[model samples]
Target chain A: MTAEKLQVAFTDILKAHQRISPYIHKTPVFKNSKINDLVHRELYFKAENLQKTGSFKARGALNAVLQLKEKQTNLKGVVTHSSGNHGQATAWAARTTGLQCSIVVPSYSPAVKMEAIKEYGAELVECGPLPTDRNAACEKIAAEKKYEMIPPFDHYHVIAGQGTIAVEFLEAVPNLDAILVPISGGGMIAGIAVAAKHIKPNIKVYAVEPEGKILEKSLRAEEMLWPNPPQYLNTIADGIRLQQTGHLTWPFLLQLVEKEVFTVNNEEIIKAMKFVFQRMKLVIEAASGAAVAAAMSDQLQKLDKKIQHIGVILCGGNVDIDKLPWF
Target chain B: MTAEKLQVAFTDILKAHQRISPYIHKTPVFKNSKINDLVHRELYFKAENLQKTGSFKARGALNAVLQLKEKQTNLKGVVTHSSGNHGQATAWAARTTGLQCSIVVPSYSPAVKMEAIKEYGAELVECGPLPTDRNAACEKIAAEKKYEMIPPFDHYHVIAGQGTIAVEFLEAVPNLDAILVPISGGGMIAGIAVAAKHIKPNIKVYAVEPEGKILEKSLRAEEMLWPNPPQYLNTIADGIRLQQTGHLTWPFLLQLVEKEVFTVNNEEIIKAMKFVFQRMKLVIEAASGAAVAAAMSDQLQKLDKKIQHIGVILCGGNVDIDKLPWF
Candidate 1:
């Protein structure tokens, strides 16, 4: 895809903010003196963990659903395939917009997550525990029911919706020198980078991912490197375990994101999660931990000297209590 | 003790708020639609867990230390006996004002709690596990060092300081029909009751405590009832395990507080803690959970119909991760 075709304009993000203002929460920016002392840089946390549906996915989902509503005069429903924050977000967004929604999840997906999707009043369809199977099921449903399929991270409206976070974050802490966001299919960071750079051209945007993810390698290769999911996915951060960046998101990320994608180990992610819980008094999921870990990692040493203020997006807090790593 | 002698004027609370304004956080009042639906009342949570030093104890401690600094010219230090939030709060308050502070904690106190006190630069004195032993140690230190005694809940300044919470809460949600607070030595509730009642004369102030604790019984007897700690105190809420109400605080409770105190079982407290963690995205200690549990309990059935808006004080979030009851 050419840069011109895939480009997400600053105006799109601003429009997304205006469109989703009533539906999504403008999550608070939290700061801690102790954390600042430890990092040697002032840190502002955009607490999307406290967002509606407990993730930044709510922003994109709501925007997409709302946009769909405006575009289609007779909206039948929306369909997505996932067993994560996105599924819950889509379900909640559909419910909020008074639309029928269906989520296709793997049969092996955690019961708690599936229950959450159902609780949000989404129709749950169990498919085989594979990406291909899940995708095929979603496709079949969309074709059969004429439901608007909302892609998790690759679509224009979704990316635009996700970009709204940066507008809110920059507004809250206008002087932020840098922002760290966790990358899954690159939708959130892609959106954030586009918005942040547009708002303040000199501001830096870094994408953080769990170790063993191939996003960094693909960025370096200048080509999409699809890792075999079962073999390569070893990180505990379930949210960001994508094999490859979306076709639409990859181009935007290549142009917008910082050159080097930061990666943190599971141990570092767990430690960061614990730190936020203990010191910051917030319960954040492991995916959110990756961003925090990257901010505090040795890779940011050079940036620390230059940047006085850093913003990290705590993307979610929907961890299953029984499965906490500490236990 | 006569009510006249221990009376805490609303002006004193206002003065405490002014003195501690810079030293403490005016914690945000959080509301959840799900929680509102569950309780059948609009519940506003005063998130003191997010407060400086991780509890409302900071307010009282800072007020007392600041008061002592203003009153005495040769202020050597301040001493208090606590194994929980108060110890850390006192140490933090002293450090903030550049004064020496000593905390007398039981030998059996958790190492994590002790480390927190020392981290605030306070002198740690290890005493026996009994209340008498801790008090004696504090007395000895105060007598030897000429340090003013900052009682956890009994003193006028401490009560006035804690009363500041109500002032802030009422300001945030002015039309609250009732306010719920966890009672330890009756200091927090006493302060809140006085401030809340003084501001909104007809507002109801209810004290919540762990089941089997004698605070409810004491309020019923119209006198002080000190229970045997080892025999009667079996609740997981260690923060509010005090055997008796403070002499100064008791009078305020009798006059300003509502006729009946609410109590919840340990099981209910754990359930509330988990609920807040999962739904509210907050990690609150069991003491905080007591207030939440009381608000959601069957005991609030009659009050639920009458009270449209209720405020529950989330007292603290300083829990040992390894010792979390759920795990």
Candidate 2:
């Protein structure tokens, strides 16, 4: 991969799928006619919220660790820093291979997410709520414990791993006109855009962000944006509050994503979450809510033309019910 | 269909499947390793929660209405009384065929449920909390409006409709040792038992109820028991809190179900709901929780020789998130 390009091929996603099929679930494509009527589009929801570890992170996390083991013989363990699903997923992936995993979590991360990381038998390290602090903690752990650091979104294998979701999704509903993906550190959408665009050459890949639309700014500037991470934390979509896109992922975003980057606020995301929870009977995290909220937004009709069929990825379902956003 | 017996033939369920395939979803069968480890058996969860109107009732309600249209000349409308999922389902089924539907509900039913009935364009009739009041309201509406009464669980068509779930469940995983069904009006279990027993004759069918163990009591007495419905209202599983099994359903219960009818308290049901909501990432109502609770119970391990593969029907997912049981 060059500085201005994403070299992660469709074959890599296919390989990732082949390697992780036993470990991950080919989550069902779900639809609610009520939402379809409101949006005036036939929307197919790729339900990765029902995936193992309750997110699509399991595929990427497992693929990265499994591929790492395939390449290196003396890998003692793996270390990574994430606030939510990725931390838990990496821990689960490590446990599967009998490898020790140390997950550094932001102190602001929900207790339910932390508890899951601990339940997977990972060494839980809590740090201050900043991307820099998380990175420092992971670096320190990797240096001292001789553990290979698995950066959440900035790696090739991780992008390829997440790309597998697109393969399964397109195969399920081949006629989808586009796919709406929720963006955090850009890995999930980056991977999705790569595979989805490859499969359906004319398919539009729309990136949805919370109130803080850093990706949009980055795309307009033709460079990755790095805003204050705390500024992005106001939204209830806790999983995708990271400030910057990855070096490797930003290029994919630049090339593959639709020009119009969609944005929804905390209220919109919560509304989408509630709709799915109450009507559709699916528990979706705030990040997934971004995609759902965007799907239901009037902006879809305001597009260059009406999209007849669309696919929305439900990224995760690890929200704290006791502390529901609406309540 | 005699008063003393259930004759919901396997062919009835098969025909029901063919009739309602376009209207209802073939809900996915979900399994979690963590749940499997806790239960010490492989449990396939039939996710009817994701069905239309967010319950398995859609299958039966649709089958009844569709079959009614076929058999009758001019069907004015369909009417039924239900406190929750069934009412919403019947309203949705009627709307599908552009048939006028009047749903009678007890005053205590959640506003979300009542709103759903209205949203589906059904005439919402609110009655007193007594089951008798609900029945009287339905009878009054059915007579005055010339609407055919589609009872929730007692009728042959409804039984056959609910049985379609068993066909889908067994077809997905044919080698199941037994199916754990959450019982309310008993039509669902009766249809399931007939279809499942016909498919796999030795397959055990276990009935799980909330705090009120009326099914166990009725089975012991060799007759359908009639207790006051209000006496059994002190449980979180509102969907299945009805007092007695249907006349037709009771005979199937006596002949097909295992001798032991397992019962769980409200606490067990809530715990199970939380597990599914948090870990499995599915929004399951308390009726589904009864089957889930039974799966995780200690009594499952104590059963005569370990029954390895069990299909647990997740009856519905129409709980009010704002008023979750744990909260």
Candidate 3:
């Protein structure tokens, strides 16, 4: 008899949805008349900002940890290196699932995120700001403690976990002509594109990368390539400024996401963030703002497709309120 | 054989709910585990921050406008005196009901509010910064233009409209031991106390007033009295700083709401606002924050009645983002 392997199949997303629903929120979908008017389209915002741990990271993290619980026995707790939403998400998931957690955060990571991870009862470790430093620190902890390493996005189970968002978003607004997604390590958009296209093949997937063309530049190569040294720190959208796409996530992004991924600058991201706060009255992080910046821009209107009803995943809302970028 | 008179009865709220359901959003009820752990009690927040015009004022305003539309024929327009949420709400209500609207805003009103009122296609008239100035200007406009005056609160229909919130809140969380409401002109709490107590006789109604204890002081008098000048501008919670309770709403406050209203200072209000932004990831106005402040305080835990399950009405989220009070 063949065993089910770890993969991001459509059925796996369904299973992930069932497994993670209890642990995370089915966050609300919001619509604003003024925002719709500004964009001249029927924009349905999937408010994952209100998700558990205040981001969609909750979905992937919980899905991964819960599956691990079912497969393994007496596993040394989970370990991950993330300085943002995913860090808190892993901690929350581990704590909820009755397991210990350790998060390796970059030295320059925001204090708020580190505090949140600690509040979830996870051991917090600080490392250098570089990607290699984060991974080395995370791997050392995993090796020394026999803790299972859960990469932020590359793992197939993590991608499957994030695919659940597409299921929920599509369920809420079934006729969404296309979905506008934010691109980080490509976990969310990859899962979203795969799941969304499977459900409705004609539904296009457009993506936005915050202040960097790494995704755009790398995809042009014959084979996928990661950024050198993998230390990206360019934009105000600190959350989505990953230097490269995940190895597993790259295929889905290259094959499914629209060719023209929107690249937005810090100012554009901030403008979109302000629009949501002033108009929709929802607090969204700059990573989500990049997606919104794409949604709010003029290019969507001039697209070739008759994209009337668009879905924008407001991916997170864990912003530092005291240090608003606008000021 | 007689027609239904304009009165804020329990049935009126039921009717208002039915009538206004199409126009307003049935906003979600949100709960944060972190917040619950901090307060040591489960708190259900009715997110009227996501309501139309970004406030629960939508419920009352829409009901009043729709009722007016049904009662009168060929009305010149509807006019109201409000410098904040109520102003934008009235404009949205009027526009939604296909009625001509004129808003008499105080000169000191925020520019964002004035812009919103105008954007809703309401004729904006600015008056001096005083209660008398606003009312006189509204009355003058109504008399000259034959526009019907829709008072911000104090009207029977308006109170009935406000009561609809209680119906929704109770429906969502039926077992709530008590409800925490933000008091402004008493329209909301009056409607809520009547409707909620009628729905569940055992339910307790507690109210919160932002700094400046007019409600507390007035309840001591022989008759329900308006503020000496009826103009109050204290505390950063500008949305709910009404100097006095409404005539119709005051009786409900005295009779149904617990005698001791929680009076949160500006500091407490701002603190609550910051907590919500940091944790729940919602941009709540200071007015809504006042209600949350009361919910977060230790007094609830020390109360005589066991408020294990508390319902808080986040009255609005029409805050000026650029001018956040905490900053």
Candidate 4:
């Protein structure tokens, strides 16, 4: 994609912030006195874990559905595939805007997540594990039924909505030294980096990933591809354990992100989750835990003591109670 | 205690609020859309679960410390016996105000909680499980060292400090119809009930308890005693599973509380914790969960839906990661 395309994406992000402000939570920002002592720098957490639908997915989903214009007026329905948070977001978005939603999912998706989707009144389309199969089925269903296929990450309006985090963060704490965001399909970080870097040219943007699912490999290699083969996915940071980034998200990330860091194993994520819970008293999901773990550990060696103030977005808090590791 | 004595206690509560405001968090009140639907009433959670040191204990501890007058100026240290939240609160309170703290903990206290006490620079004293034993040891230590003993509850200053919750809640949500509090040593509820009923006579005060532990029975029986003594504390709601209520607390509660209710079994607490974590996206301890469980199960059968707007203090969020049912 060209630089002009990326700029349009950034512009759409600004517009999305304006459009979705009424529906979304501005959510609270907190500084951890306990974690601050350990990190030796002021750490601010944007609590999207407390966001409606328990994740920032609400921002993108609402933005995407609302941005559909006259050309897409004949949209028969909204369809997307997600294991949990995104499906719930789509269902909520559809319900709020008076539309039918059909969320395609793998047959093996967690029962707890399925229950949430059903609770939100989303029609389910269970399919195989392969992303190719799921995408093909969703596309075919959209073509046959005249449904508007809502790509979870690889869409302009979705990125724009996710970008609103940057706007809010800048408004909340204007002179942030750096921001560490968890990376999955690159939707959240891609949007945040674009808006934050655009608004404050000197501010640094960092992407944190689970050890096994390293998207940083692709970003640092200057290639638009996953580091390992397509089949590698083993991490407890389930939300960000993606095999690849979206077509719409890669160029924005490559252009905007200052650095991308990988955290330790699931053990580190668990440790960080426990540390934040015990010290900060904030419940954060594993993806959010990865960002905190990266910041707390030696991954950001050079920037550790120097960054005067840092911001981390707690991306979501939709863990299955039964599946929670502690029990 | 006489009604006039209770009136004087209310006056002390007012004084405590002024004393603790500078130190404690006037935590935000939050509402969950789904929880509202379940209860069939508008529920506002007074997020004391998010307070400094992750519980409303901070208010009481800070109050007790600050209430130390000129005569107590020779106090070499402050002593308290607690297994968890109260100990952490005292440790934090002592550190914040530059006072030495000696926390006499039961030998079985979680290492995590013990670490928090040590982190705050409190001297840790390990004792037997029973409060009588721990209290006696603390008393002896206080006598030997000329240190002031800060009782968890029953102490006028402690109750007055906890009363700050009711003051803040009523101030923030002026039209609250009722306030439900989890009863342990009775300090939290006694303090809140006195403040709430004193300010607004019509506002109902309900105290929730785990069925296995019958402190409520003792309250109804008009006695300061332990009831249905645990074979060993089994409920996951460790924070509220106190062996007994305070002597000073029971008298205040007898006059102030409108009703007392109890919930049984680990399943209910676990289920409530799950609901709060999933629906509210808030990290609450089992005591808070017990209150939410009480709200959901119509534990207060006598109360009507006419109590439209209610406030529940999510009293604390200090659970051991290893001990959390959902992990």
Top-lDDT candidate index? 1
Per-residue lDDT for B23-139 in model 3, tens only? Answer: 999988999888888888889999899899889888888898888888886766789988688888899998898888889987777788889889999998988976788889999
Candidate 4 clashing pairs, residues 3+ apart or interchain: A326-B327
Clash pairs, candidate 1, are none
Candidate 1 stretches with Cα past 4 Å from truth are A1-6, A227-232, B1-6, B227-232
Model 1 TM-score on chain A: 0.96
Residue-by-residue lDDT tens digits, candidate 3, A248-324 = 78778767788777878888899999999888888899999998999877777687657889999999998999999
As for TM-score, the candidate ahead, 2 or 4, is: 2
- TM for candidate 3 is 0.96
Over B230-316, each residue of candidate 2 has an lDDT whose tens digit, in order, gives 345468898888767776677888888876888999989989999899888899999999999999998888875557999999999
Better of 2 and 3 by TM-score: 3
The TM-scores, chain A only, for the candidates as listed are 0.96, 0.95, 0.95, 0.93
> How would the candidate models be sorted by DockQ, starting from the highest?
3, 2, 1, 4
Interface C-alpha root-mean-square deviation of candidate 3: 0.8
Candidate 4's displacement at residue A93, Å, is 1.0
lDDT of 2: 0.87
Q: TM-scores across all candidates?
A: 0.96, 0.95, 0.96, 0.92
Candidate 2 chain A, run of 10 with poorest lDDT: A224-233
Candidate with more favorable, higher DockQ: 1 or 3:
3
Q: Second chain only: TM-score per model?
A: 0.96, 0.95, 0.94, 0.92
Error of 1 at B131 (Å): 1.8
Each prediction's RMSD to truth: 2.1, 2.4, 3.3, 2.9
lDDT of each: 0.88, 0.87, 0.85, 0.81
Worst 10 residues of 3 chain B by lDDT: B1-10
Q: What are the interface RMSDs of all the models?
A: 0.8, 1.0, 0.8, 2.3
